[model samples]
Target: MSFADHTIRVRVPGTSANCGPGFDAIGLACTVYNDLELTLKKEAGVKITISGEGAANIPCDGRNIVWRSVQYLLRKAGLLDQYPGAVIHMENNVPLSRGLGSSATAIVAGLKAANVLIGNRFNRRELLQFATDIEGHPDNVAPAIFGGFTVSTVTRGDVECFSFLPKFRMKLIVAVPDFPLSTRKARAVLPAQVPMADAVNNISRASMLVAALCKGNEKFLRNVFDDALHQPYRAKLIPGMYDVFAAARKAGALGANLSGAGPCLIAYALERRHCEEAVGEAMKAAFRQHDVEAKILIMDLDTRGAHIVK
Candidate 1:
């Protein structure tokens, strides 16, 4: 069998999941990104090299998540036997384990790159399903694949994603703490169940949030981000988490929330307000009060999710 030797490069955006009260059902893609370049080889094994964020810790073997994802797609497409080797390079900009969906970037990149190599046999929806299967949820992966803001639900082993780009512009001010919080540790702290009243609170707020964001109704957005589901329980893990949110709001941010299973926190502000710097500074000062140092990134939404670079 003869095949063309070409490198498929994929760039995928970082994502923030569970925006406010939506839990694992909501996410948005940010401008930060990770790039993966996959070149099918005539050899028989995979070679991976990683640079930038988490490079020291991320594996370079077949155990690498990116390679595993590539293999997963190839196996599904019955091309594993035909293409037994690949050379993959990952250049990462998204911070690892910082609630910014870095892992999803890797997964989405690998899947998309492999699919392109196979002549794009799968569409975005099929790619979403494969990503969800690997991620165990669609929150991060949905937005990573489709960009913009995504609301996702998994039903009977199938994933459904509805994505939208906000009609209005806004600043996503992320305060990434120096320390990383593993998603596993954050989820372990959540209680098995919550009171019915708390459940109702989250439901109403989550619904309002989606509508407000979609409609670009800033008035409706204010005060709708309060969560009864996970934030309170996870608060203890992140010192001064509530204080940070309060400070951002006080500093002119419209709303704020824990970014995914987070030590990182995100705030929303109108882009035209030109108050992003102030919001970021307030969040930073608040974290400093808790003896934690954080890096601030004032990012905008990335509407182009994952795409080939070459």
Candidate 2:
């Protein structure tokens, strides 16, 4: 579980947190990924290289989330004081600040790198807790660490989560608009309080959504994603958000949802995979009506979260 040499590469999957009604609780990991490679240096200095997504905007220094996460894990493990310098290289595919859990990938990658470098003193459970602590929530981090489907929460200042291998094999179609929606800005639009009716509605739908996914019941799934919680308030930020959902459904999607404080919309399919193209086109057309271009990605669930490549 440990490497004597300070060179290792790790891959972490991209994550989409909150599948409609399960806000800050459910996270789904996709096949898209971010890879991080670290080589220990003899001298006390670090070097970094970045490609893809926010490569131009992201920092290549200690300020980078990946780098900061590396240091954070090392410190927590009591290895920082004696740490050697390391060069970190990131090959990123997940879009930053687009609600695809880019930051969660970076955090998981860093922790995995450090664990392997130090002989993996921590187990996956420990690593997941550490990652959740770093990310300040388990939604994205939990799935990024455990992959597949995850349900997570913080209980009494501690992280509690579990992963599930879904009974249904679902195809995910993610359509991202040209514009970005920061989680901060999206949260700002929501009212501080909601009516008891709205709260009850989300709870009912969330329960049904979980049941549908577990039983592979597409009939129940079709109507289960109607969330009355976060989406309605945040839809104002993304032009045509609801329209895109409508379009995807019209194109044969079993259910459609805003992917985590999105400008990204994700849909599940139960019918012909050929309908993926139709759904993608429909979503894109909806975005174009608002003058925003978009990208539609077709992916399956990632069964594995983060792992090292020898």
Q: Pick the candidate with the highest TM-score.
A: 1
lDDT of 1 by residue, 131-168 (tens): 99999999999999999999999999899999998879
Model 2's lDDT to the true fold? 0.85
- Give candidate 2's TM-score: 0.95
TM-score of each: 0.98, 0.95
User: Model 2, 1-310: lDDT tens per residue?
Assistant: 2332468999999999889888888989999999999875546767999998889988987788887888787788877756656789999999888889998999999999988888788888888888888888889998898899898878886888878876767788999887778888988888889899999988888888877778777688888777888999888888888889999999999889988888788998853456888888999999899888999998889998998876
Ten contiguous residues with the weakest lDDT in model 2? 1-10
Cα lDDT for residue 151, model 2? 86
Best by lDDT: 1
Q: Tell me the RMSD of model 2 versus the true structure.
A: 1.7
Residue 76 shift from truth in candidate 2, angstroms: 1.5
How does model 1 score by TM-score?
A: 0.98
